[model samples]
Target: MRRMLKQSALVRDNNFKGGLKEYAKEMGKIGKFATQLKIAGYVSIATDIVGSSIKVYEAAPEDKARTTVVETAKVGAGIGFGIYASYLIVGLATGGTGLIVIGIVAAGAAIAAKGTSEIAGYGAGYIYDKVESINE
Candidate 1:
């Protein structure tokens, strides 16, 4: 059955609400790593953004998925920044030795979250592609 096959993708975890929650958290984790690497001058922010943009447009809706991606990215970014803002602020306030590092970490994490969302969208596009391809 088509519905049964679709359910297969979920494996041990299958629920729309559960999926979204996992997606957002995964994005956040990816973002955190991205920030740390970017701060070390080991990565390009532009590259990540470009990749995400492409994904957004791939399976895009009538209004363009980029819009949705951006909106969702913003929400994700906001959550990331919120989680770290206080630490960054206090570090700066105390004249910490590495506020720059803190900032980079925060920024990277925010962007990473966006990129993760992009990746998720890309997966969705993959499924669409498969359906469009068909064996017949």
Candidate 2:
């Protein structure tokens, strides 16, 4: 057991709780709403590709401090999407046409949102990584 452990260079405690805890903080004052997530390699790549155009609006000094805009936007979107999905369900009563249209729109919106959000999220992560690297 000791030989195997030594050969593998295994540490007793393998708690990879992330090294850069406050990556978002490194890019401070980025706007009214700011947030970050501990994403994986694939996400970072995706973010890099799509975040090329999306500009991150930073907060001005004169503006009063408030809750993070990123978090607020995500939460609001989540809630909004939920409601929107529910609309499709309720609209089923209107008629087959209404249901069909709503269904099609909802499906398209969901797919687009999924891709857009991923790219946006990756953009945020990419920014954080770059900021942190520069700071270091």
Candidate 3:
């Protein structure tokens, strides 16, 4: 029984050392790939924003163009804040350095921010319309 225990211990030590080295190498590769993914994510966001801006410009009437611009600005600000805040919170919670993980969190936060921005914009527009009508 004592000899069996010693053999098992040696086996465990050998396997653990080899496993840790391989795991470290794989983690380094994942980190590099995640960084590339993060860059692609940001590029995609920029293109989406630009494409949406162009569509808004084409669809909005000459008079309401300014309103559209303002609403777009508000949405942009909301998304920016949402992403930043989410990154901070998630980073603190998980202590993660993986770009892909943070990117996923940011994406979800951005979607939530979009819904919030739309609601706020609608309310602001309604209030503006009511005030203008009252003034006239």
Candidate 4:
């Protein structure tokens, strides 16, 4: 009986150790995935910032009509890029399940970029017209 009890205890010990090893492996995988997600988030945000800056820059008034048209196209491209980046970020962050969240965030970013660009463009144009008028 004593020998049998010892053998059972040993088996239990081994099983426990195996379970712990498996759990550790799973945790390590989770950690790696989380780290990747974090890195992706940072990259997305950086890209968005750059896109927004480009839009803002394009908003500034240009003296030539051709330049203005080119700037408008650039601003549109910037907004489009920002929307795509935001969608990618949200999809990655939520594992592609949160459709509402992705749509809202993407839309919000695009709208914000458009509104900001328009405001800045109008302001710059107003200032330029005022300056030109004053000079004349």
Give candidate 2's whole-model lDDT. Answer: 0.40
Q: What is the C-alpha RMSD of each candidate to the true structure, in Å?
A: 20.6, 23.3, 8.7, 13.0
**Worst-scoring 10-residue span by lDDT in model 4:** 8-17
Better lDDT candidate (1, 4): 4
lDDT of 1 by residue, 1-136 (tens): 5456345443224322345455446445545654654454324445555655665577448646445555446444444554465455445423322335656655666566556655655665565556656944
Residue-by-residue lDDT tens digits, candidate 2, 1-136: 5455333312222321222322223223221111221132235435533442233234454321221333334334444554565455345423223334544655565555555554554565566557657988
Residue-wise C-alpha lDDT for candidate 4, range 50-80, written one tens digit per residue:
7655655666365464335434554555556
Task: Give the distance in Å from residue 59's predicted Cα in candidate 2 to where it truly belongs.
Answer: 29
Candidate 3 residue 54 Cα shift, in angstroms, is 2.3
Query: What's the ranking of the predictions by lDDT, best on top?
Result: 3, 4, 1, 2
Backbone clash total for model 1 is 3
The prediction achieving the highest TM-score against the true structure is 3
**lDDT: worst 10-residue window of model 2:** 29-38
Q: Which number leads on lDDT?
A: 3
* CA deviation > 4 Å runs, candidate 4: 1-97
Name the 10 consecutive residues with the lowest summed lDDT in model 3: 9-18
Which 10-residue window of candidate 1 scores lowest in summed lDDT?
8-17
Model 2 per-residue lDDT at 32: 16
